[model samples]
Target: MWHDKSVAFRLVRKKDVQETGELEAQARVDRRTKNLTKRLQPGNIAVINHSDIDRVSAEALVECKPRAVLNAAKSTSGRYPNLGPGILETAGIPLIDDLGPEIMDIREGDILHIEDARVYRGDELIAEGTVQTEETIAASQEAARAGMSVQLKAFATNTMEYVEREQDLIFDGVGVPDVKTNFEGRHVLVVVRGYRYKEDLAALRPYIREYKPIMIGVDGGADAILEEGFQLDMIVGDMDSVSDKALTSGAEIIVHAYRDGRAPGRKRVQDLGVEHVVFPVTGTSEDVAMLLADDKGAQLIVAVGTHNTLIEFLDKGRSGMASTFLTRLAIGGKLIDAKGVSQLYRSRISNWQIFFLVVAGCVAIVAALAATATGHALFGLISTWFGDIVHWFATLF
Candidate 1:
């Protein structure tokens, strides 16, 4: 069934052999895009196993400025309309798709040459894959759009199933753990490592400064908070994608564990000698962050970089966003998206503007004084005093 579906949307070639210009670069291979990004240097080929590469991962890859990308998995599985491949292709990064598991056979730091959609090691052809061009990507995207109705139906069905199973989250707010971070009657900013989180955070600088909300970062979102020059009050997640630096950033850590009480990330935090608390829950870390804030009586919950749309949920490749959907329903009027807030909220007055206003006011006062008769008398007295001071200085010299 999978084979038939893949075959239906397979790239149709004009010619069997298209001229792919010879390109030589060192290869950095990893099944995980996040881990690979740290090792990727400019001009090196990034080999990854990410399927339906999400926007955030693609943005991270693009920042490294790699010569090309070689994938062991499909960049777009026609599951949903993911923008990752388009982002890479638009940035002029050649994405070689589904080179098969054999592509992983190439060791790290190996020098490689790409020619005509084939990878070579020292003049020997090691692997071959489909070279994703703009045309092929556009076609795949169009097909994905056409398939959305089907995907949405499946998503809705799954969401309903999960909602039936997890009604406690909506009604009773079960599994919400107590933490030291206070949210009572105060604004709480819950950040997730999703679509344009950085831009959204940048836009919320004024809100963050004025309100001084309790800052909560979920996984890599903690790193995002630190990158924006803010201190995190709490870091909640499975702790997979967050950096060691962020973990040690003195923020209180809350590890999200499975319902069976198995916390895989707890050991890492322990190894780092950092103090942390374990919150066993079934849903995602972002879901837990919102639930935690909401349950603790947060006046308002401002979310940054959270996945709210159907396309984003589909890009995550989940059966359904049941926990997120229910969590939002539970929170109700308390939650506000950062994207909307960032657009609507503006800084009342900047420091520079206030400084200029003060200077302008002073200048106007000086001008007014200079035009008055009393001002002339004052100036004459000031000049006499200045002359006496000058004479005194000369006499001393």
Candidate 2:
């Protein structure tokens, strides 16, 4: 009976469980969004502690192309409708919001698996957080827009405070530092790394080529100038985010120091052995650039990428934009936004356009000649010469 017994064959297959599990990706974490973005690579998840992330920072993050963003703090804290989170979310990058300080426990370069609102490390659950979907972000943005009045009131209050404190420097330029760079009786172009800066610069190409204004780049704007194949006449900033290439680009450097005589960026410039002058004052580097240009007696100051709106000032997340508000007031008639200038001034006709115009004029002249009796004789002679040349070529062939 045992020898006659045949073994029944059966087959079993394992389910594909991993396919439906949490999304697994590596992470790059930093308390500072700027610093984190430097090391962020495509497909790496970004964990940041930035609150009310600005548009510039969001654009930087989007450029890195991360798989997802995990924020330890609020991306938009209803602070005047910041464009950062919306920018990230619209780019199709998933955002896990308000993960709390516990999320920081995840080390840089650690593998993470995210599902729903939970972040896990292998089999162990690490943290639970709110995932920012389009609807949630839109609601937050709407709330922020509603809160704009409060922000505006606060901004106005701050501007008045700054104006009262720094009123003397506004008019008399008593505390402004003297530099070797002369802006007297010449146009000065002050460039900042604000919204649509590259586009504004492109639009100003003809103006830059023609007027040849004294080019002053504020921090990273110096790199932008260098990128556009233009010479940097002077670079004015705190010297935090600019590149070494820009530092060595033969432009005059001015280190913006604090009012207490503490210049954090000075040592970096000094260590690089680049010649620079220290402008010790209050307010932002942009404020300093405008004051410098104004004090140096610039005939006109054209600003590129400078923050002009309430949202822009808020996006900077600095109360010191009060200085910018005052700076604009101080330099009133002389200062104009690049956008305004670009609109007002017509660009000179390009060389190619001139060439085409010349060609068209020659063709018109030829047609005019063809309509006249002298032209008929000239055409006949030219035809005879062409026929002789064709005959010669035909005989040679």
The prediction achieving the highest lDDT against the true structure is 2
Per-residue CA lDDT of model 2 for 1-397, tens digit only, reads 0011122211111222112223567889999887888789988889999999899889889989987788999888987788998888778677888889999989988888777678877778888778776677778999989998998899889988887777888888988877888889999998898877777887888898999999999998998888888889999988988899999888999999887889999999999999999988778899899998998899999999898888889998888887898899899999988844445567699989999999999999999999999999999999999999999999997
Rate residue 289 of model 2 by lDDT. 93
lDDT of 1 by residue, 1-397 (tens): 0011111122223324333344678899999898899879988999998899888889889999997899988899887889999888778788898889988888998888776578877778888888887778888888888888998788778778767866786567776777787788999999898877888898989999999999999998998899999988999988998999999988999998987899999999999999998988766788888888887889999999887888888766666465787778778999998855555657899999999999999999989999999999998999999999999999997
TM-scores for every candidate against the unseen true structure: 0.81, 0.79
Rate residue 183 of model 1 by lDDT: 81
lDDT, residue 60, model 2: 85
RMSD vs true structure, all candidates: 7.7, 10.1
Runs in model 1 with CA error above 4 Å? 1-22, 340-397
lDDT for model 2 comes to 0.84
Of candidate 1, the 10-residue stretch with the lowest lDDT total is 1-10
